[model samples]
Target chain A: MEIDLQGIVVIVGNYGSGKTEVSINLAVNKKRAGVDVKIADLDLVNPYFRTREARSQLSEIGIGVALPPEEYLQADLPILSPVVAGLIKNPVELTIIDAGGDDAGATVLATLADAFNGKSVHMLQVVNPLRPFTGTVKGCLKMRNEIETASKMTINGIIGNSNLIDETRPEDIYSGYEFVKLLSQESGLALKFITVPSNLMTEIDVSRFSCPVLQIKRQLVPPWKKAVKLS
Target chain B: MGKVLMKGNEAIGEAAIRAGCLNYFAYPITPQSEVAEYLSRRMPEVNGNFLQGESEVAVSYMIFGASAAGERVFTTSSSPGISLMSEAISYIAAAQCPAVFVNIMRGGPGLGGILPSQADYLQATKGIGHGDCRLLVMAPAGVQEAVEMVMMAFPLAEKYRNPVIILGDGLIGQMMEPVEFPDHLKSEPSNKDDWAINGMDTRKSTERNLVKSLFLDPTQLNDNNLILKAKYERMKKEEIRYEKYNTDSDYKVLIVSYGTMSRVCKTAIDQLKEEGIEVGLIRPQTLFPFPEAAVRETALKEGCKAVISIEMSMGQMVEDVSMSLQGKLPVSWYGKCGGDIPTPEEVIDAVKGLNV
Candidate 1:
């Protein structure tokens, strides 16, 4: 298993689109590969279940984390920090910017227009075919344009994060890969990766993915798992 | 368009782009509104981000969110908005996130008038948070300085991993002048994949990554604070930036000032020089980790009678001057508040009152 997307890779989706879960899993996967990694929790748009929620585990893996400023950690007014600019201007390989959801969440990307001037900064939009505004190609385009407008950056790539969590199937990823391929051709967005549940990976033909396949483990424990032993 | 005359606010926007920063987040505010207005259109042309947030509070946090994801984010506001951002600024510092804050200061206790003022001197330089956090505060006097400081701030913020403030008054924000943008040299933003929470992949099988600012254990917190303090101390050695005006004379009066007040002091010093009075000025560019040693040395050598601290506020910077002098010189303080700028003539009168 190799999560090779290096430096900062921003994983963004519409609200409740499992963007944070992808981000958390990505950081851990990369860190486990013996690569120096860091997870910056920039999801100030949402108050709960941000990447910072698992700071203890991330720190345990020896991966650095730069979260929203301490004062507004709970306040949640729109968490753009100066340190973000500093981080961009001097990135430490694999600097993943987990943007806010939709155009509104993507709006924070505009504040980084200065730094993105030259770099082929890959802007990826995660599409969950199951989610509304993403079920059709037109909706995807609109979401894409909105993200571009708000981020003030072009959408260079797409991630198929189509899943049903507990009920995720290999078929969903294949259909998603096909759907976004049409989108990539129509809208000029390269289908970068297809994400699936780790439990579902063995069932899916990994070779079918022309792009990379990211097997994500659920970071959150179900309420029932709360009573389980640590070991 | 060859160098259109621009206000300091407009220059901030232009300079940000020139500094290789195309992203700007801000909400409308009196006096400094031009920053948002200018960047709103300019950003798109450069393929940059410009968003008018719902409020100053939201706007600053938007900057936080953007910056955390590793981008050069900035937000502009007056005193009130800055006050709202203080909490976020502290977080940015604690989290070691780097971004720029443009504060076009205005006079006030609450909802101060939309006019030029430098009352936020204390707030800008001093730690804005409860924990141990010190920001790199840059005070820009003119539109040129404002633009230059903003360009400089990007690198400074990255170098120290701290927030930098372009602490300007409303006058600088509003006043128009000819300006030149920097021939920005592009540099790669560091490789922070180790900490940037971009996405999960299969190749690297692992649990999850977290980014936060909470240290529970008392000893651990203390250790973290010590590490932060050491970083600040290193900054004092490496990033203590300033500019001196006419200090080469056998001047008895050393006028200590910054931002717009420094310009006023410059004018005052020139007039005094014309009148054959020996008066010099020490203008600090970096307000935090201030040019304390420089001012103290000037007062110490040749027996300068007074080091007068002039500001747009009643006397925020005077405290720095007082601390720096430490009984070596009688530190006099003079200034008006609430957008009332003292003319050069009045400043001379202040110098004469000291009778140095």
Candidate 2:
């Protein structure tokens, strides 16, 4: 299926919701699709697994990545570069901002409120039903409301991403689809897409999903594994 | 379970839960916040309790309260936060409460930078708290070893009825490593019924138990101190752990290192050996009940001329290395503070400069 993701896409979720992995993969996917892509790492909370960690890989793919200064790279203090506003203001074919998880990380978006004004930004709440607080439809809606309030932006779409690391299965994707589908209905948001590991793509029934499937290449891996391992 | 890649902080948190520590109380701090974030999710799924306390000081007491009731509990923090909890840590030590604490240490004297550092070496071992209290500090070189050490921390704490610390540098906490939660490390916590203060109803005993560190009487306090001293002595006898690389051979020089710095030393040692330098390393796994005997024996080797202490701190662990050798051999130091780790090549240069 052809998934044409465009314009300014802001990805936000709770902690460990695979937002960074999704953002990294989205940038690569969009770049491979022959679109000009630039990703902004607005995650001021988490020091690990930020989009900037994959800066070299993204740059190699001809995708632009804006991050804090070299000195403040590892600091928890928020130091959003001025270029982030520029990227958001005059975005490429597709500009993705990988936000930090939870309200604490989403608050940084408030600083970019002016730049995002009058822009067709598809603020999507990425939901991993496996994580805490988002396990139920009510829980997911509450989190969505919290993120909207904190970022001063409305989330217009839902992205279902659920897996148990190397133990992920076809059923996990299908079950997670059902959970996020309910979340979409309750929150009055569109179902953007569900991510499946590239290897597991053939195992799942494409007809089971109403939205396009984004083939995920696990890039944000821990160092112990030589490469991303898919069961 | 099969091997999976995980960050050191997240892995440590999962290891604690897998080790049957269901209660976690900690405040969010960099280089170690993933531990709290991971547990905040996993704990509820496993029917465990997790809390993000207002501050490190409050979290320490929360751990103390849960542990006092005979529950296995733990917390994680960096240098400045750990220093904030030192008062409660001393109380937990004096009260003989068995709990685990993980310090993914960063550079410090104040609110230092948040990169990888081992500046807490002195604070962790020598003067963690105000009183003459000691923590059984275990340092792990990698994420896998960090997992094992955290799993073992609970049992050691119970065995001696004292607080045990898993001391790791921020690199270990931040880096991703492929690790398998070994089956051998998975076990139930020991019974704390003998001394726990779970009230008379819960214990089903006529006598009530009080767990407190306060003793206003001078003579009684001294006796308590003596008893604590004896337990520390027992730990020194039984809990010392170290790893020797190339020390089995009559190597020319001895390098003392621990935690993440030890791994760097190992890399340097490998390169030096390629050039036929024959340098050796002694990595102390337990920093408090330090491998002093192992260090002394290795340093006193007939062919070993000098001992070098390499750490992320300016020169903290060097004191321990110097004290261990007792002037039998010249003790030297090389380190970088404020979240800067020496590269393997720099370590090689230092060893070559020693002219061993």
Candidate 3:
């Protein structure tokens, strides 16, 4: 379960598979681990619930967030910030690129292939078994092939981030772990880690998981809730 | 079959399929484009038809065609796209064909940002298209409600032979929530044999059924409008849906809101109760058959100081609130437009200002 928490890590997944949540928590975890972390918001597909929504919170913690220019920040057009290319070319202790959802969202990564050529990138496919299209092993494999073909980058590992938001139970995490374990066996990709909501961490037994357990403090919430303050 | 986590857009697409709506025609627009994206793959699996029309104008006509043929059909689009579809909406409404339209609203008078906004309140409730046209409009507060409303819309549209609208904002279409497709809501399209153009051979009738909105004679046009008026009146008698929160208490401020904005008001109401400031909320689930009587009665409750319309629009629903009150009580408005939803704290501030 010793994941190499270094180099450029690109996170990809199906739409609504909690990719942005995993990306944000991973960057925060790496930052607390005393590593210089800078994350890029490369999501151009979804108009809402992207990494840029957490820009102020992430910036408060000294984690650099690269996003599209001010005018194009809210636009859905596929405009990648030049700073993303710069982040990919230069190396920090940990650089995370949060790609958009599905093959359509991941297609933007193919445009940055030149920047990622020389670096050792760990492209992890985040699988939330509760989400549509990735609920089965066959569906997970199909998504893997599509994402790999679309991004022109091979996935090296899997990040299990299964939950039904507030309705998630302990069995969901255990069953999600088992589901992703089966996916790793079928796809021959390593299981890097599994995520549990920080509130539910006490209910879950981490020893059941063979990989490291990443506690996710839910950041991307509905507008009505108090703004997430990640200390 | 079982409960699963899904985005509102995907849940709406599945709900239509479960409701036996086999035909879906749409032009992609955010943040509701996922409905088209989801149905494109799902429709074929169920032996249904999914078509991406060239534009919203074309898609709206496609809905008209399928509905006239006595088939269950629907389309999903955002603000500007719905504006494009309004012409056909008028045609379908006048033709008395059953059709369902889901407008996952984005901010706009024209081409506004693709963030969540309830700015289309007036457009949907009062003036959707030209002429005397009214749609049975339902608004949902969350994803599960969106699914239920989408499922109910088809049957309601057929029941009255008029177009039905599901009015949601971008957040309702984009946010993720766990939803269950109730087995009871799975329904077959009601018998459309009476007036549908289902071909002479199919109906086993020698006469052809003509479906058209044109009434060249002035008297005939007036009769047509009368029939439409009767259906709208029946809807007002039966379909005025609203949820009252904290109204049991002697509240000072009565807040009228709908869609996602209402959820924020609910949170503000709960927080205000803890601080000893009483605020009540009326969340209208149906926008067209607005809960007028309920709002008026609640606004006249004991210790009620004033009524405020809280929305994501620039005071669109306030007019409806004013109309409902009929000048019996003072009505005011507070909101933000172009995608910055008022947070619970901001809503609390607004409510406290009313108290002061």
Candidate 4:
């Protein structure tokens, strides 16, 4: 099944909930599918393991990456590049904004309220049950409210991104899907999609889930791994 | 609980709790503030105490106070925060209090960038504080090892009745990995009655317990230093831990690296072997004990021509590498400290350039 992700997608989630990974993979997936894709890295809360780490990789594949200026690339300041607002305003086939973790990180989006005004925005909350605050349905709902309030945007969808990194089992994916399904029912938000690592794609029976499955290539790895160098 | 993917900083906070350390005092710093964040929510669940001190200086003394009261206590901080805590760390050592300090090191010397760096090698191992003070330092390569080391640190600190340091780089604190905490490592605080100022009634001893770092008498101070010196000496004998990789092969270069840098070197070694070049590695799990005999023996291997200390620092660990070799072989340094970790290919190129 194809992912119907288009028109100003803002990915927000709790800390360590795989928001950056989901944002990167979603951009790549849409780009390869012949859509004009651009992504912005607004992760000022974290100084490491950010979407900009994969900037060159995205650019090599003909996807535009909008982040801070070169001088402030490594700085943990909440400085938004003009290109981000420009990208959102002009409206590409698919524009993904990888917001930072939690309400604190999402606060940056409120500053861009003028750019996001009157836009058809799909603010999706990437939920990883394995993380701390987003573990339970109540916790996930609480995070949704906090992120929505902080970003000045409502979370219209949920993205199930549950895995234990390299140790992810097929059962984990199935259970994670069920957890998000319950979350969708409780919160009245559509389950936009669920993510399965590219390595575990074949191992998992994708037919079991009715939602679109976004196969995640494990970016944002530790530096020891063969990683994409920061540009 | 089953294994879960967790950032190293969060896992460390949980590991301390699992290890029965219920008291946590810390000040927030990048790449490691997640530890304090995790504990702030978690400590309340377990009815444990978690306090964010006004500053790292105050936090270290809070650790000292809790540890002196016979409570298992620990703190996490970045490079500059650790510098502020150094004064109290020395006092804790002098007073013989068991406390754990986790330094998720960022680039350093001053307020360096928040990216990963191992430049705190000299600071952690040699000059943590004033006087002839030394801390037992353990370096973990990844999240799993980080969890295991944090769990082991409490017991080890109490065993020596001194402070222990878990030296990790920013990558270790920032990255997520699947970790399963060992159930057996959970332990209760032991031997606190002998020295801790818990309570006179609790100990039921006629004499009250006293905790003080100041022995104003010159002879008394000398005796205290001697006692500390003897403890460090005993640590060298009983606590030296290291791992040797590809040593049995006729490797030409011996790389002494630790923490995350060692993992990069390991990958380089594998790639070099594929290209018909043999390179061995000595990774020090414990930085303090230095693993001198291990390095000396590994470097003495017949075909090993030279040694290199590959680290994120300019050349801090190279001194220990040279001292370990005792001038038996040439030693060099190869690394980057400006927050960029050397890639495995770069490490392979460095190894190939040795021209052994």
What is the TM-score of each predicted model, taking all chains together?
A: 0.59, 0.78, 0.98, 0.96
Pairs that clash in candidate 4:
none
Cα lDDT tens digits for candidate 3, B26-96: 99988899999899879999999999999999999999999888899999999999999999999999999
lDDT of 3: 0.91
lDDT of 4 by residue, B24-129 (tens): 9999988799998789889999999999999999999999999999999999999999999999999999999999999999997799898999999999999999
Which ten-residue region of model 3 chain A has the weakest summed lDDT?
A222-231
Model 2 has an lDDT value of 0.85
lDDT of 3 at B321: 88
Q: Tell how far residue B111 is off in model 2, in angstroms.
A: 0.8
Q: Is the docking of candidate 4 incorrect, acceptable, medium or high quality?
A: medium
- Residues A148-203, model 2: lDDT tens digits: 89999988888898776566779888988998888888778999998998779889
What's the distance in Å from true for residue B62, model 3?
0.8
- Model 1 chain B, poorest ten-residue lDDT window? B187-196
Per-residue lDDT for B1-91 in model 1, tens only? 2233454776788788877776788887766776776687568888998888888778878877777776777888888888888888877
What is the Å distance of residue A163 in model 1 from its true position? 61
**Considering TM-score, which of the candidate structures 2 and 4 is the better prediction for this target?**
4
- In the predicted model 2, the residue pairs found to clash are A223-B176, A224-B178
